[model samples]
Target: MISSISTNQIKYVLALEKTGSFSEAADLCFVTQSTLSIMIKKLENQCNLILFDRKSKPITLTKEGEELINQLKLIYQEFEVLQEIIQGTNQEFYGNLRIGIIPTLAPFLLPLFLNKLVTNYPNINFSIDEITTQEITKRIKTRELDIGILSLPIEDQELIQTSLFNESFLIYDASGTFSRNKKYKIKDIDVSRLWLLEESHCLSSQIEKICLLKKMDTSKHNLEFKSGSILSLLELVNMNKGLTLLPKLATLQKNLIKPSYIFNLVNPIPAREIGIITHPNFSKKRLLDILEIEIKKSVKPLLDKTKRIQLINPY
Candidate 1:
């Protein structure tokens, strides 16, 4: 009776499950292709079952193999969680946290919060990916990232969002050409003068709603660039000459040169809701909770607390 299996066997099985090719899985596992095939054969023999249908294109798992691999994945994730827990206790915040941040927020927001994270939890290491909101959601759902910082109303039932702060958007126009009026109405926007991030960014969609720019109207707007970072857009505005919406967080510091050409939208204002997002099944709940608390604390001082803001539903 074959009663024993090794951790090496499990690793080989998982590698095959991911790559769907024995040679690829073996390369990933740092073994010969024949070695991986032999290990999988041994595992199946031990259980008296076929784990994979080798003849199937792309290597489909057998019915029993599918269920077994599902359990194996859970076991592997749990093992990681246990390893983190043990490591986290000895040192303040030990273990790597893989996080994804939306591009618009990453540049302005990370510097504000990272220092405190390092000071408080020096043992924790970070693997950060700055990506678009769409990418963040996809990666989080696939278990590639532990947390995502995104502008909310993220509707995915598979993820949970913690509202961290409500930041306002200021309507901006080319300085001398348009009034620097504290409150410019939506209808009053010089639509022809408006500059926008290219199509995919959620920020672009929110800007369309905020400025009341019809889809066709945006199509008519001449120069189009696909960037979500307000800072870069601001530079473009300064050089190329056009108006764009900016997050309040981008404007908080006096050092950020507000090109002598800028204006704010009036009452019935527009804003974006920034929040911490995590997969519902994220393995590091305690770390996320700690991160949320720290981020909120850091952001409170940077905000213009006097201004009223609105949260958009992330459809």
Candidate 2:
């Protein structure tokens, strides 16, 4: 009888991808180099394909090998879920809960709720990844991440979003150019002096859209700077005498500048709907409910909420 691909063989391939060298992969898989190579060769023979480019120094995956590895990842995930299902039937959310949070939210939000979350659920093991919104969505779909805290309208039909809060943008000035007004107009502001996070961050894209700066050619400007860290931008704003917009939660953090410099956007105030996103098939109902309640308790009191805030459409 023809044998099926073994889980150990699949693991060897994944380890090789991570390590890039067979010796390192063998060390990780706790086997001799010959043993690991033999197992992979067996898998290749069973499938009748060359899984690796033997001519390459560290060995890159062949086109067919890449496709096969993707399927292997799915199979491995299913095996884990099957085990979780059996164990979860009797336990009460005591195992590791994998979570991903966007860069914009992780710094400000974690400080507010992480301590309380750990104190209350001491038994619950938590592993969190600070990543981009797009990455979070991809990982959740593949069952790599259980939950994500990010600005919403993920727009993926496979994911379920639960609104947690609405965070409005606040204009923080250090350039000494912006005057204190109840309302600020985007056009009136100097786009040249505007400091923004890098394009990889969803928040920066949201700001670009709302301000009608979609085609804003920053290259012509005498100075160009893009940062991924809000805290870094805040420091640069103060040092370089520049200006930037900040999310409500970020403004509440440690700031060298005074509050008198902060201003709000006028009618139809621009905001991003912050929410928890999970796979539709994720079976962590009790855990999700508890986390939602805890997060709301920590954040709601600090937020200056209003019906006037408009969620920017993520196009």
Would you list the C-alpha lDDT of every candidate in the order shown?
Answer: 0.77, 0.82
- Regions of candidate 1 where Cα sits further than 4 Å from its true position: 1-92, 180-182, 216-224, 253-255, 259-262, 306-308
Tens-place lDDT per residue, model 1, 92-154, is: 657889889877778788888888777667778888899888899999899889899989978
Any residue pairs clashing in model 1, and if so which? 153-314, 175-261, 183-266, 184-266
Question: What is the per-residue lDDT of model 2 for residues 1-315, given as tens digits with 9 covering 90 to 100?
Answer: 337767788899888877778999999999999999999898888888888887787778999889788888888888889878866653555877899999988988888888877766667888899999989999999999999999888889779999898998878888777776446766666777777787889888887877779755667446566778887878777777767788888878755447866877767778888889999998878899888888888999988868888787544
> Residue 156: error of model 2 in Å?
1.0
The candidate scoring highest on TM-score is 2
Error of 2 at 231 (Å): 1.3
Predict model 2's lDDT versus the native: 0.82
